[model samples]
Target: MNKKLIIGMILGAILGIFCILGARLRLPDHASFSYLLSFWYNRVILGVIIGLLPSLKSLKLSLLRGLLVGVFVSFAFYSATGFLDLMGFFAGFVYGVIIEFVLFKLNQMEKL
Candidate 1:
């Protein structure tokens, strides 16, 4: 993998784990590992955002591209949020699609 992708993955994982640990400490008795996993897993939006960093130059849009980005993001999130592995995967995938669509619209507007 390229340096940017590797870095993004590492950063994403670190952020995910940090968030989980922070949440656990703050919530204490209320925090369940499963719930924390689900919460962080849903944060795929963060990954989608990370994926868009490189595309800011070209701003191209494609489902495949989105999925690839989502996969990497999911990987990072999963690696960080070790509580639930695949939980973040699905959430991240859907979140990536949504964010990509939003970014596409925004980019189109910027052209006008």
Candidate 2:
């Protein structure tokens, strides 16, 4: 198993949990899905994306993969609740781009 992927997943989940907790602290009476936003959106999905960073060897690949996942997830959400999940799409897109950049830069630094 890929250690980096495992660690990334663990860290992402933890981060998402913290985000949910913080939001709850601020708004105890938050909406239903609001609580799961961080976990489902940022942690699980984002973790899976980041964990696949190795095979997503290029920025283009990352963007393509991300866009596909984003659109699919958004579609699922929309179909389930008849609500267009703009935030989910946007967040997934941004996560894909950002992770690509981070990984690219890390590779560059390693080569230097």
Candidate 3:
């Protein structure tokens, strides 16, 4: 894998672990699994940022491509966490799509 992708994966995993740990510590003892999963969901934003960093040098990929890559990265990282399952994977994918859409809009505005 390219350095950028490797870096993205490492960063995503670190952030995901930290997020999960924080949630477990701060939430009430009776917190639902879904409530804890919410913390993992937020890590998708970090995945999105990592996705955008490598692409800043060239906007050659279409927005769809960027979103796909972002989702893939997020899923891969989330898979490392024993607590996350399929639902968390899907949520991360959706978060990636939203992040890519926002980034696309911002990039367009910057060019104008």
Better of 1 and 2 by TM-score: 2
- Position 57, candidate 1: lDDT: 37
Residue 36 accuracy (lDDT) in model 3: 54
Cα lDDT tens digits, model 1, 38-81, are 55654534643554464453445544455667776667656755
How much does each candidate deviate from the true structure in C-alpha RMSD? Answer: 8.0, 4.7, 7.8
Name the better of 1 and 3 by TM-score: 1
Off by over 4 Å in 3: 1-61
RMSD of 2: 4.7
lDDT of 2 by residue, 1-112 (tens): 5654564455456555654565455556643575467335555556555666564456677667655654554455445544534454455555444544554455556521
Instruction: Please say which candidate is ahead in TM-score: 2 or 3.
Output: 2
Candidate 2 segments exceeding 4 Å error: 14-30, 33-42, 53-56, 104-112
Off by over 4 Å in 1: 1-61, 83-85
- Give the Cα-based TM-score of candidate 3 against the true structure: 0.45
Per-residue accuracy of model 3 over 52-78 as CA lDDT, tens digit each: 464453454535555676566666655
